[model samples]
Target: MIVRTIRVRTIWSVCVPLPLLSLMLVVFGLTTGEFVIAGILPDVAAGLAVPVPAAGRLVTAYALGMIVGGPVVTALTARLPRRPLVTGLVAVSVLANLGSAVAPGYGLLLAARFAAGLVVATFFAVAIATAVSTAPEGRQASAVAKVALGMNLGIVLGTPLGTLVGQHLGWRAAFAAVAALTAAGLLMVLRFVPASPAPTGSMRGELRVFKGRDVQLALALTAVGNVGVVTVFSYIAPLLTGVGGFGEGAVPALLLLYGAGAVAGNFLGGRLADRALMPSLAGLLAVLAAVLVLFWAAGGVRILAVPLVFVLGLLAFAIIPGMQTRVLTAAGAAPTLAVAVNASGFQTAAAFAGWLGGAVIDHGPGLRSLYLVGAALTAAGLGIALYVLRRDRRPSPEPGRRPEHAGT
Candidate 1:
């Protein structure tokens, strides 16, 4: 008698390193939970018998949680081995999502979302740190990008799917789906991610990295650089419908297009940053500014505007790896804390962008004016990047790690 055995492998088994893949999956789950709320906001508002604006506080609460919780969690857990720490964080997230799924009122749901956000930024920080530490020399940016690619996928696939589930079943079903995703992610992380050595330094010593001017600059650059993209993205639905005259039904398809572009731009940016970090950043920012200006001029014309959405997404994401790499390189000694702080800075910038974009809409020229303001804001960020380029003249190498090249 002959016996045959069956084996199955997932697409995730492609080429990424196992540890990084595990980290990526965990990140994907967290990101899905973070973004799915937007898709289900109206349902949540109705379900809780609250005004849509009040229900909107969940988003703000989560951002606030990230800003406050990242440092606290990272500081408390900084010395632990990466595998368990990350898995533990994912576990906490699973519970938070479950709590969100069962929340009896808006207050409880808001708290659950905050709890969920508590782990996200620090999880990202640790995941990125582990990936970089394990990467081959000179591949730091690629490693960063791979972990970040999970985020893009979450936006592209997870959010939409979760939204679908919410629409068909109920909003609570979406949170349950997110919880299930995190649970699966926790298992994959435990399976594929190798146990890391405990950190050699204490939290206090690691925190000192922020004192460096380069580190400070990297953090500021991240916040300032993202404002342009956030300003447009926050109001994308309105922009498309109001100016481009696209029907509401068309927005989803256009967003999918944008997401596809983001995936492509992310990998491309990673490769470019691996080649020449600072220069690539500068060039991408300049291009992004130009694209924003082009978008402003073309937004009224559907034919031109549709393709610009893809290009806009491409340029917006193309700079992310460079921004992340700079921060990691600048604060090599304190990856966990530095990255958490960077996450907070980016969050703060997003919050500011929302306010600024609203002001532009309410008081300034009009809805069409958003793109111009976005372009101007992007130029301001580009100026900062250029200043860093001029001041550093060469990329600051990661601590104790040899400089890969002068161009970085």
Candidate 2:
């Protein structure tokens, strides 16, 4: 009887985090829909009767929508109830993906992709805020990590699978698959997620987070870190093919390794942040900078490049939970809007980094220069992190008020 009781308790302990699990699934579905386009661009171009380069614009459209939409949605829906809001976001994802699957032309497809992007960051902000708000005390970072785990899994599993499906079935089928997964996520969220009231603040109050130095610093840190990551990642295929001398077949396996590393980093980062947020963040950034430097130096050696790619992915993502936690903690009363804005910062950085990387490729530096650029960006981010840490050490103005440092 005692053995059975212990077994039941163990299962319950694992099962108690199902809300996070649901959020993960939702993230996975959304991320897959957002990223799968890269894998299916050729098919989309063929089907829409547009040039492949034109099809590439679908990605840019999505990023632009995410950049513009996240904060707007958060501000406009600041007072809406949480459960229905999340469910509605998933519903929007479902409908948007369906639109993508069935759209008849390039213009319609672009609209669908943009519409999908519009909700991606907003969903992340709300879902992450919900995850943190509902999490057990002392486990907020862990909850956020679990949510990110789904995204990593999507990168590891979903994009490849979508590509395979698009290769065999059709690109539209890939979007249809995304819609189906999103529908399942919708049902899970509606069934399992508990309702929470929105934070009691006006749009003006939520907007006030921008004025906080710590909040602005956090956003800058996220942007700098992401610029470092995306600068290489956006052009990883070319770097591998051009610099590493890797064949097309090896790219997927290499990316899988990176994704696997990301999964490990996600969970580890959350645990570390839960323990010592600022130090963990600083350490992760330092490691990331070092890895980027290593990648730049050894990119031509396959054995070295493969392992460094994994380490690069690990260090790159390990900072996410810490960054999110910092913003949320610093923002105090405006967690949702702060998170939304942070997501926007990341998207904007990704767009900017891609453009910068393209310029380097087109100009004299060539593809190998991307890693160097990435290293420089990460080093800059580390400097910002160090500055933030220094600021945290200063004494607070109020006698009883503790400084709003990273973890505390």
Candidate 3:
């Protein structure tokens, strides 16, 4: 009896909460759908009778919707129950993906992609908030990271698989598969995710998070750093083929390496953030900048590009947990809204980066210059991080005093 009890306790300790597992599946499905477009852009363009550059705009449209949707949806549904809100969001995702699978024209497909993006940021914000709030004490960052692992895996495992499926079966089939996965995720959420009480705060009160300088700094860091990462990542397929001299058959293997690095970075960042948030963030940004420079210099050589791509993936994602933790910590009174806004910041950066990459490919120095652009943006982010660190060293304001100005 004693041995059995110990074994049961150990199993319980190792088992993840059902709600978290559900959220991870939702994130995985969403991320896979989002990134699969990048991998299969050529096929999609050919199928839709559009140029590849034009099809790339689909990514920008989706990102723009996320930038708008995160804060808008969060604010609008601030008083709703958590389970229903998340479930409904996932349901929307299923429909949007299905629409993508069947859309007959580029315009219709673009609309579907935009709709898909709209729900993703809102879902991610709610899921992260739910995961962190329900986590065991002192394990919040780890819990958040675990949910994010789904995204890392989606990149590592899903994108390559989806690309292969698209290559063999068709891009529409890939979107159909995502729709099916999201439908399954919706069922899991409905069955396992418990209802969470709405946070007690007026819209005005929730908006107070924007008043804090720390929160602003954190959001800015997210935006600029993501710009750096996405600038290169948005054009990765072409970069590998055109600049790295990689064949189409080799792209999936290289992506696998990058994805593996992302998985490692996700957990490592979570652990470091849990221990020391600010320092870890600053270090991650610095490493990211350095890695971007390295990628630019070595991209021409396949041998060097292979390992550098992996390291680049690692350093880029390592900033996420730290950034999320910093935003939540700084937004003491309005974590939910703050997290939503932070998600918006990331999407906004993604939109900008996508546009910038397209411009570079069309008119500027072309694909290889993406690395230089990424490095510059990352270096700027590092400067902001240093400023934040210095600002943190100053004495705190009086307990009852609120700052006079606060708006992002």
Candidate 4:
């Protein structure tokens, strides 16, 4: 029976990580919904009998829901047990996807997407905060990495999987698949995650973190970074086909390679952040800027697309854990609200990027300009990081001003 016991132990090891993975799946659902337009825009337009551009507005509505829900729900549920709150949010997400799958008209599907985005916002905020709070201090990066894997998972799997489902099934089938995944994820969250202790704080107390410059800078950095990345990434399929001359079938393979690279970068990023948080961040942003420029140059070469996509994925995602660490560090003791707000900022940035990308596509500049825009935004974020680093290097102004309260 020793062999049987060992197998059980191995299974537990795998199961222990399920709660974290479940959160990522929730993220995957959100990301998939956000990106569904990429593959299903035509189908949705055809189905709804609306213009493709009008169908794209569904993405906008979804992002708006996420942006609005993140901080509002975090603030409202500050005292709720995170596990239950998160599980409930996932349930909402499942319902939203189900609604999208069954909706009779374009307007109803649009509304459903917005509702799903709302749950996405709240779930992301609570999950990240609780994961960080429960983690052992030194292992915070690893803990955060577990959850951040959701972003990578969403990036790697969400689009391709959603597209595949849409292709084999129907556009509505895409939402049906998302709904099924959400149900599975919610069940896992309920079964595997331990109860989260409620925080003892007023909304005012949690809001105090915003008064700190470092916190503000960190939020700005997140917003800028996300906007930059999504601006270009929102049109990735188009870029591959229009510029890279890749066939439709080849896009998913390229995305999968990028996802694999992101997973590797995420581990390295977490480790390096644990070792040297700030410098690792600086180097990462630098790499991000470089990668965007390289992407622009190689946008047309199918042969070079693989390595460039890998590098782009790596540099873009590697910054996530460190950024989370930075924010938590700056937010002082109560990190839940800060984490939630960070998510809000990220979603807002996503909304901005989507709108910007759509505008570029509409105004006749073509998809290639997205890379230029993304590169510029990355450079701006890098500049912000460098400024923070420079200021951190200086001595405190007063005996009281000694940077002790600085968090992220």
Candidate 5:
């Protein structure tokens, strides 16, 4: 049953095979592209002569591209060699980010952002599959976790550092740097990522998995269950600046704190999900709703707001492992397509987050109202989660290890 000799120790292991390490770096670049925009929204708005709320739509556009692009790209390229397809996707991202850096107008920059996002989910699906295919028997979970660590690192390191670049330099420079990162990743992929046979599964069989009710619930939970956190995070820059009275300079530091919380949460979440998937999700969502409420009430106080940012990060990331476990368990038969669907659903929530946060800021109560809005949305998701839990009649799917998210 052995595919090769690759070994991924655990969630905390540092030593990984070069191919997986290369894929990790590539994912870091992709996730940073998704996350850094949040930190630089105010700067991008000013640079492009648009409103901050309007700048938020750049995020929506990128997410919409991912939603549309993942399935189409995967379907079109399913039978192609894995290594070259992965490389081509990263190459596309590099070009798109370069376009973002040089575009003179807001419209063109938005287009560039969308193009950059198109390759993200497809890369993740292929990259994870590549990691799995190359792993020793009984270690697919470790392989998935290793790639997911790239995403966590993107949140913890990439966003804060990228924010610093955008803050000190021009926002355009930030995109350029991401392009450079991916360019480096492309070279490493060429050197390290081994060639693999094209996927043999048909699109018909993959589509068939979605007809299951369990799969349907899992996808809905992914889109709905996570929207609240995504909402607050989308406008986090303005909230901290306007409400917490921090200067734009302070946003990176706060995001760093949030990132630190996310790292801690990622490990804690995996352990919990491995033990009791549904119960843990229900508990995490309930706490997430409470945390959002707390954020709404105390967001203005500088002292409280600081710690609350960390807590919000903790609770938000904590729910991801359980949700991912749900999807992998429900549709493990077509993991690549299953992962693609879940990734799109994850981006769908992010897209909604940009729209809903902008709507709240522009027309509703105000920036602070975003927290309450998030709380309500999370409560709705929690209700949906509880209904799914109550109607359960079978064992929760055990996907060996916690399949940490690439979409966060």
Candidate 6:
């Protein structure tokens, strides 16, 4: 028994990292392809004969697709095999990115981006579900963190990767590379990822999760918290350079520091959630709220801005895995759809935040207002979480150890 246990542990240690890498690659491909368009906005506007602001609408269109597609796909595909569905979605993403590269006009590019958004939303939820399901008992947060790691890496790596490709070869070349990466992710999923049984539930049964007070509160908190963070981050470059007076070269370094902090946050958050789920959530949200406020206060000091950005990244990311864990815990066994819904909620709220931030900035509001908005939203999230924690009072379920639903 001991020898067998050791063998199993060895295999899992090796095998699990493969999934993490593959998941990261998937996020990388999606993010690189999607955000690359932002950098090429000028080129695309000129190519398609549209005004710059109108070209920006393409991004808005893609986000709209993401917000609408995620839950719709989850609800529709509730009965499809999880692993295969993920593979298929990624395959489609590759095709979409490829299409974006060769698209003839703005309308076609918009269509391609919409298609990519559809695939990305589905890809995210599936990846998270697979990670959580595969995690060992008491390690679900870590597993989900692996997916979060992919997300952070994407933000850190994607734009640069896209820029390099576009600079050397053109924006078309960048999209092609992202397509190739997506294809690679698909192959990895097919080759290494084991099949997962479909989540069992009617759409109605899944919707019941919304009826749960904790789930509703959790979803609300996620939306508000996401908006809060994005509000400030949307204007981070301006804040750092204009207000903090950091050089352009320093911006990339600062972003790297933030990425490192995020990695640390993900790992630490999982451990903290494992220790005491509710308190971890509360503490992280509170710190996140405070960090945004500090960013507002520290705007004039470069030294302060650097450390504050790091703390902001840490606090913002720490909430993700814990929030995810919270939903799974409260939802009990059948969490697949609920988890998907939460992902959608985050995306939707981010859209609202981007709009809100833009509105604030448009009014000649300084970058500090971004932090103010973030702080307010984060406080709201923390308040909701606190209320839920107080109401539940029951200890959170152990991470990675989910109860089986009736069908499972």
Q: Return the top candidate by lDDT.
A: 1
RMSD of each: 4.2, 3.3, 3.6, 3.4, 7.0, 5.8
Estimate, for each residue in 49-94, the C-alpha lDDT of model 6 and write its tens digit: 8999988987887777777777787778778888778867887888
1-408 in candidate 1: lDDT tens per residue?
Answer: 122221223344545766777778778888888889899999999999999999889999889889988788888988888877877888889999999999999889999999999988889998888788888899989999899988999999999999999999999999999999878877877887778877888777988788777888898888888898899999999999999899999999999999988988998899999999988998998999898888888888999999999998888888998898899888888877889888888888889989998998999999888998889888988998998898777666788986644322
Pairs with backbone N, CA or C atoms under 3 Å apart (clashes), candidate 2: none
Residue-level lDDT of model 2, residues 1-408, one tens digit each, is 999998986786585477777888989998898889999998898888889999999999888888888888878878888887887778888998999999988888899888888888888988888888888898889889988887898888988898899889999999999999989987888887887876786778788768878888999988986798788999998898899999999998898888888988898899999998888898898888788778888899998999888887787778999999888898889888889889988998888888899899898488897888888888899899999998987777587765565332
With candidate 5 superimposed using the best TM-score fit, by how many Å does residue 191's alpha carbon deviate from the native?
4.6
Q: What is the TM-score of each candidate against the true structure?
A: 0.92, 0.93, 0.87, 0.86, 0.79, 0.89
Ranking by lDDT: 1, 2, 3, 5, 4, 6
Q: How many residue pairs clash in each candidate?
A: 0, 0, 0, 5, 0, 2
| Candidate number that wins on TM-score, 1 or 6 | 1
lDDT of 4 by residue, 1-408 (tens): 999998987885664366677666667666776676577888988988999989888878887887787788777887887777777787788888889888999889889988888766667767777676666778777777777776777666787778888988999999888788777777777787778678886778888778888889888878886578778877888988888899999987888887898988887788888888778888888888887888788878877887898888787778889888888887885577777788879877876887798998889577887888888898888888888788778777776565664654
TM-score of 2: 0.93
Which stretches in model 2 have alpha-carbon errors above 4 Å? 1-16, 398-408
lDDT for model 2, please: 0.86
- The candidate, 2 or 3, that scores higher on TM-score is 2
Instruction: Please give the lDDT score at residue 89 for candidate 5.
Output: 91
Give lDDT tens digits, candidate 3, residues 347-367: 778778888999988999878
Q: Which portions of model 3 miss their true places by more than 4 Å?
A: 1-16, 39-54, 104-107, 167-170, 241-245, 358-369, 397-408
